[model samples]
Target: MGSGRRNLKNAAVALLSPIPSIIFYLSLLNHCQRISSTASDGDHSLSLSPLWAWCYYHPLLLANVLFFVNVNVLFWVISHIQSSHWMIDLYWTVIPVMLVHYYATHPLAQYNWWRSKIAISLTWVWGVRLSHNYFRREKWQWGAREDWRFTDMRLQYGKHWWWVSFFAVYVSQQVFLIGVCLPLYVIHSVDEPLNIWDFVAIIACLCGIVVAFSADTQLHDFVSRNQKLKELGKPFVANLDEGLWRYSRHPNYFGEQLWWWGLVIFAWNLGQGWTFIGSFINTMCLAYVTKLVEEWMLKQDYRAEAYRLYQKTTSVWIPWFKSSIGGKDKKA
Candidate 1:
């Protein structure tokens, strides 16, 4: 029965992978047609520049298409990988995709020009690279399930709810993507030249990139080391004491917060005035996600008790202090 269920799941992934692209493309084309028709009805109908029209209307569509395509590919590839439960694996990417959809449909998209452009660009880059990297790292196996989180979710959601769960997963990702990238819309709206605020935003973005890349690199290295150890018949143990992990229980999470908030800062620099709402939302959501993950990690491993210590000492969302001089941030 388990084997049969796995086969069904793989088949479902195969079928659904291609559907998102078609839907994305169709939606984009439809939106374009609407915009063109609307423009043609105005007095300056003939004056509407084709280039301008595309520049203004195409970024969101392009971003959506890129995100959908990458995620679908990820689904096809990961579904075949015999590792990790599928549902939890789906959560990471799914949340972001939902944010994408939300931003695409949000009022900010209509008002924040530069914000939209930056958001679209960042989404395209992050989604494509991450998806490709993920697909390349994992191999396929027939009748294999996905990430353990997915399995847990499947059990929790019940056996008869896969269809609903599937759509929810997809839609959730769209909304996440939209929400996280909201600052881009605000950033794009700026009509002024770069200023001090832009410099501040640039610094924040650079810091985010460095810290995020460093944390991920460290985590990957740790995982690789563990795999090597396993190959030598060593038991798997939680290794969170060294490097950035020592500083914060979740340095990668911290970096992620910085990256998104940095994007929000960019929107602030662009100063679309009311577009600040997008930045505010992004920051708030980042805090919430970080908090949730921290709590979950704390629960997942009580033996180490390192997470609780790290939480107490280090700043939750910001990488502000050193662990050595001050000791674990007693008031993290």
Candidate 2:
């Protein structure tokens, strides 16, 4: 009975976690609408307020402000309550979808309607796939576990994790989430007609989604098989070097990068090439993350030698044919 009740509570928490954020966004949207109406009616009282004016005129800035309050502040408190920071990981699949719609619904939003729809629809597809993967990895249990990286950091920081996490987990996410979604802002800010680049972007984004889905599926299946083997007292597989893993050490990361870079094409085609900065920064961060992940895998006794060989032959990313080099460890 206790376990069942706890499961129910967790399910509710997962379902309702976004309600406060949605409410805050809607409230802000309504306020922006009011400001727009009042300003048009020559009521300078509200428009004269710089904060309101910025919210009305700058949707990108408004999103950042909302992130500060909703994620940085609200999520931070919730993490303390739950004694976990995994909620941010879940929201990573959510916030882009919200930000895209926020840009579309804002009164100041101006763009080709068809283009906006395309971008918004793609964002939804990406978010849904990612959310599905997150839930699957969690065994459909919300907040069951925090990320291993966060667990490591907690151990590393000891008592200081409480405050260190405020900056490390939440603030860093503010930068990453907002940065990656900059293309959404670009898509909504321009009024350009669809062109060849739009079609190119569509292809690239779809390809990314497919590749990521395949890689993650393969990885999940591999892990599940290993678990079963362990349970049966059989020797579990030490490494995965088949399917997408054969071509790239991290095909999933490559696919995710492809998706973001693909989105950048849309903005670039619309003459907002600077929007690439977001995707570029994301890629750099991913590189560092990839290093950390590799280091972790190498630390595992069973995986160390096999992964070293895999690393020697497979590309770090960008899915290419395996190298001709043998599995012998390179001398320092």
Residue pairs with backbone atoms closer than 3 Å in model 2 (clashes): none
* Top candidate (TM-score): 2
Candidate 2, 127-161: lDDT as tens digits: 99999999898888777889999999999999999
State, as a TM-score between 0 and 1, how close model 2 is to the true structure: 0.92
Give RMSD (Å) of candidate 2 vs. truth. 3.1
> Lowest summed-lDDT stretch of 10 residues in model 2?
323-332
Model 1 lDDT tens row, 24-73: 54564555556666765553324435743453455666556555555634
CA lDDT scores, all candidates in order: 0.54, 0.86
Residue 236's lDDT in candidate 1: 62
Global local distance difference test of model 1 = 0.54
User: Model 1, stretches more than 4 Å misplaced?
Assistant: 1-129, 132-148, 163-168, 187-190, 235-237, 273-315, 320-332
Cα deviation at 248, candidate 1, in Å, is: 1.2
* Model 1, TM vs. native: 0.59
